[model samples]
Target chain A: MMQETVITNANKAYALLKADADKILKLIQVQMDNLTMPQCPLYEEVLDTHMFGLSREIDFAVRMDLIEVEEGKALLDNLEKQLNLIHEKSQQR
Target chain B: MMQETVITNANKAYALLKADADKILKLIQVQMDNLTMPQCPLYEEVLDTHMFGLSREIDFAVRMDLIEVEEGKALLDNLEKQLNLIHEKSQQR
Candidate 1:
């Protein structure tokens, strides 16, 4: 598998800029998953805006190589959409 | 404020390497805060081991300068003990 067809063409070029990278990737998946927590200077203002929106979608999917940079592979490819919105909000409870 | 006294000397130089940076900062605060979530390649194997253990405690607190790399100020200086372990596990319920 040639690197999963270049990450399925970088997830179809991140579906044409994944709706502004899913707005800070859904606030970094609701602060990971406690569902909320952003108070002190807004918790460093949302972890410095989700570390600059997931490092600008892993630097534009590694300048179009899609991924493969010393194993990190472009930040696990945007951490698979913050773990699919934390399992679609825990299967809507 | 001279950058909060150099992040309180990088939280006292991360309390002398804050006990191995509080062991991967408490597994990146229990995968943020659901308390636990690690499966499927162990979830990119713990987000690549908490992104190489919080980028090696922000590169040894930015090579001992303690912190301050532009407004990020060295990753909100390790997101303040992952927000005090999610408020001490919500004040122990």
Candidate 2:
């Protein structure tokens, strides 16, 4: 593909990833709200797994030259930080 | 919480997981459709990472007694089969 097309696809992919990550975070928060057990292993497991997937997807984009490696890593790092905040919020409840 | 409430929550979680899984699959298929390279490592990486995440989520649900172990395994198996089909379709293109 042309350089322009590649850039466009990369931006599109990043946008989709960001949108989905936000949605996933909201879903996890919803689960946490209804959770009776403060130490819900199941909830943690799902969140961890989801984060793992996102990290890999970002890496893949970087490797495909669709996005910069720094960009991908930064995105994952931001998501991880958000995930930790969510966990902390749940723990406070 | 009461057993009834637990059951209700479990059902809701499963429903949400199922819905999200379907959405993810559709998103992946879209990515595959626009892919110029048949052997897109990035695409496969994202898909594999996603499947890994889902399997972990299912395992957590089973362990937490939200769903039966067998049911969790079955769901993962079916997803794997569907994922393989998607991969095959992409390869044929």
Candidate 3:
């Protein structure tokens, strides 16, 4: 019964995180959409703020061992790749 | 020479990514540390902003096949776990 309860609670939390992530992504999209050709301070500020929050959450997870360090490292690697691509693309234009 | 160039470039990008992530984490910590009693809207805002950015970057990486979706999924699962724990602790306190 306890195991079942844990599963249900975890599942519920999972749903909430997914929903929260979706909403934030949507918010980003809205910002990106309204982006001027240069996509001003506000756009970058918003993006940086969001990205920073995610990293902190990941950092906390690692510190707490809720997620393996390797996984967090991998996520950082992936984020770095995307960040570089975005930076390069923006610079190229 | 070509392989060396790719390696060097990727390495440089990795360093930048690490630094960027660290700075962002510091910024979040600053916000967190400044929390007065309840840690109001701004604190949550900063945290959520960063988390969402991380998720979106993960999503884009998955779409580009730069990172495996399973890896991204795992990261999300871990984030959800940490969030729940944080929420619970906050509630109990």
Candidate 4:
């Protein structure tokens, strides 16, 4: 029963993470579509700091055993694959 | 010159991401050492939210051509592997 509860909470947390990631990606896509280079360095700086913070959170989760390592990787990999596709599309522009 | 500048910025950002990730993992290790289960659900909730934000930032960067998809994956994979090692050690306990 205890194990099941933890798993359920962890699963819900993962879903929230996934949903937020999708929202963020869409925001980026919108920004890209509306803007033209050269992008302001400030934007990159803000984004870098953001990614840094996220990576740390994932690390924390893994260490705490709050989420399995494989599941964490899947969350990150999904973002990477989606971003790669976006990058490829932009390149062809 | 322009291409070189962008590459340099991206490289620097990647370095920051790597460094921050390492710091986060270390922090988690420290927390685990001092604490015992069951962990606070609030803690997991906070970490999940943090990770979600960071993934978004990474996606934004990729969409902006600020970083390559491969590099982003590498950053995430490093965290995953390290966490896996930590998980394995904990399991053997």
Interface RMSD of each: 16.3, 13.7, 14.1, 15.4
What TM-score do all the candidates reach, one by one? 0.23, 0.49, 0.36, 0.45
Score candidate 3 by DockQ: 0.13
- Which candidate, 1 or 2, has the higher TM-score? 2
| Sort by TM-score, top down from the best | 2, 4, 3, 1
Please name the candidate that would achieve the greatest DockQ relative to the true structure.
Answer: 3
Candidate 3 matches the true fold with a TM-score of 0.36
Q: DockQ-based ranking, best first? A: 3, 2, 4, 1
Segments of candidate 2 deviating more than 4 angstroms: A36-38, B1-50, B53-93
Pick by TM-score: 2 or 3, better one: 2
DockQ of candidate 2 compared with the true complex: 0.10
Q: Worst 10-residue stretch by lDDT in candidate 1 chain B? A: B63-72
lDDT (10s digit) by residue, model 3, range A1-93: 645644553344334333434554656555444553335766677666755655554554444223456766666566556555555555565
Clashing pairs in 1: none
What is the C-alpha lDDT profile of model 2 across B23-91, one tens digit per residue? 667877788677645477766656666778666555544544556888777777777787678878877
lDDT of 3 by residue, B1-93 (tens): 645644553444334334434554556545444553335766676666755666654554344233467766766566656555555555565
RMSD (CA, angstroms), candidate 2: 17.9
Using Cα atoms, each model's DockQ against the true complex is 0.02, 0.10, 0.13, 0.06
> What pairs collide in candidate 4?
none
Q: List, residue by residue over B1-93, the lDDT tens digit for candidate 4.
A: 655655665676566556656765676566556653315674454444444544544554454455688877777777768866764675567
Among all windows of ten consecutive residues in candidate 3 chain B, which has the lowest summed lDDT?
B9-18
